[model samples]
Target: MDAEIEVRDVARRYQKGGVQALEGVSLRLAPGTFTAVIGPSGCGKSTLLKLIAGLEAPDAGEVRLAGQPPEAFRAGGGLGIAFQDAALLPWRSVEANVAFPLQVLGRSRRAHAARIRELIALVGLEGREGALPGQLSGGMRQRVAIARALVSDPQVLLLDEPFAALDQILRRTMTIELQRIWAERRITTLLVTHGIEEAVFLADQVVIMQGGPGRIAAIVPVPFARPRGPELFADPAFHALCESLMAQLAPIADSR
Candidate 1:
């Protein structure tokens, strides 16, 4: 089933620090579509993602997934999240790590054995299923993390700069891999990224944000066709849109 996300006039404040991370933030992610949120540092990009993931509650307003509260849907294994850190168990093999969620949910590992293996292959980690995370490269580990996130067949996937740690070459490669993986399922996805090109390449809409009580600055639609390739990076139209987004974000960054 497809999943839709809605955040209505959401607001969040950190009482200890007396900081308002987000204010009057609202968005709707259509079912099976991809959306990327980009902004300068401390613009509450990650905060918005957490609110949508149900990892944190808003100080005011509401967040819903498929008409149910995020917490409610999340409890049913309908949500999956991957962060910059792979966070895989150093001791567990790739397949073992992927299967961990099912174990945590008290689902039968035996029943999910094939599914786990399939996800390993999907992330291009087929032969490495028995390899421990410690033995894998940074990008490989992140691929395992992606597989783990998909093991549950989640209806919604949230990515928090999953490629931020990789070098430029690896980051671009992973971006392509991610685009392919996302195409296979078309799960409703929200990605928080710092790279303007990455956001444009992967998202159907690019949401620019402003800091100091973060709020949406602009939402730009990406009309490019699907399965976007590396060549898109060199396309004049692509560069123009990215440059336009940069222009919009420049003032916001300066203000911060």
Candidate 2:
């Protein structure tokens, strides 16, 4: 199968200088795979997402989507992104927010209404379609944002700490919801987050990054079976994986 996304020795630096956000990073994501990137703050996790989304170009190396340049894929709606914040329009009702992307793509209302309804239901916000972003809780808003991201039917989904703002209970709930959605949609997903457990819970593979000119330190495959539940968190195997990832992150933590 073709790689859904590929990064080859990618590197990036800001205009201010002396700060290399990423250095010689590379990865290949198989089609329909789910991967998570976890690292310390400022470790270029978000930068990687932006490069893949074509929101930022790398100073060196290449980012490709299905053998095409990042630019082409981005312009063709091959990628979808969700940020730390929901970034929803407060004025738009839930259904309108989910329909925003379809409208941008010039899909007729009649053509996309059914899709919009399906997405809202997929995100578990079926009856709340008429409400505004401000009327929903943080978790609900993030769900709306997720629905909008999927409305375009993207080949790849890029998420940057999307569940960071939710409280513990809600965050866990969102993780399970995300897993269910991914299983239903089968889209390749790349998530950048600082949470170890979140990474382990949602990813088929976890890529750990080292701080200060970020680079991949380790690639850990999640050995657990799918359909994971809260009970998995209590398993010794789960804690062991967390400990191993924590060990890799320790140096970055100490340097800060």
Candidate 3:
């Protein structure tokens, strides 16, 4: 089967030869798959996401999405991205914020109005559409950010530690919420996060990266059946998976 997204021998260096952000990394994301990348603070997880999103270029090797280059795919409305911060315009109302991408692509308001409403409901923010970003809670703002990401009907969603700012309970809630959204949309997704348990819970595959000149250290398949809920956290299988990931990441921490 063809991968929805493929990274072949990718490398990225930053600071004009000061630091290596990523070195010799490669991975493939299956269609409709949810993959999470986890590593230490400077492990290039976010850099990888930027490469796939075409926000940054690889210093070497290639990143392809459904057989096209990242820039081409991104320009063709094939990619969506949500960052750690909601990054919403404080001045824009919820509906307007969600509609921002569509407008940028020259889509008429009438053309995408129904789709915007559907996305609003998808993220469970129906009546909040008229509110400004500052009026919403952190989780709600992130939900709006998610709605905006999907507004363009992207084939793949790239997330960079999207729920990391929330309180633990809210973070867990958003995790389940994100899974539900992914299942409903069936969009291939790659998430960059530092939380090991979060990676195991949300990913079909968990990729652990080594620190500094970051590189893939391990790729572990998460065999847990989904639509995973809080109960999955209590399962022995889940804990075992977390333990295994922790073991792989331990060496990276020790080396620093």
- Give the best candidate by TM-score: 1
* Tens-digit lDDT track of model 3 for 170-252: 99999989988988888899999988878888899999898678899989999988788889989998999899889888889
Winner of 1 and 3 under TM-score:
1
lDDT of 2 by residue, 4-88 (tens): 8999999999979779999999999999989999988888899999999898999999999988898888677777789999999
Worst 10 residues of 1 by lDDT: 100-109
Candidate 2: C-alpha RMSD to true structure equals: 1.4
Query: How do all models score by TM-score?
Result: 0.99, 0.96, 0.97
Clashing residue pairs in candidate 3 are none
Residue-by-residue lDDT tens digits, candidate 1, 1-256: 9799999999999998999999999999999999999999999999999999899999999999999999988888889889999999988999899998888778898999999988998999889988998899999999999988888889999999999999999999999899999999999999999999999999999999999999999999999999898999899999999999999999999998
Candidate 2 wrongly placed segments (more than 4 Å):
1-3
* Weakest 10 consecutive residues of candidate 2 by summed lDDT: 101-110
Superposition error at 204 for model 2 (Å): 0.5
TM-score of 3: 0.97
lDDT of 1 at 104: 76
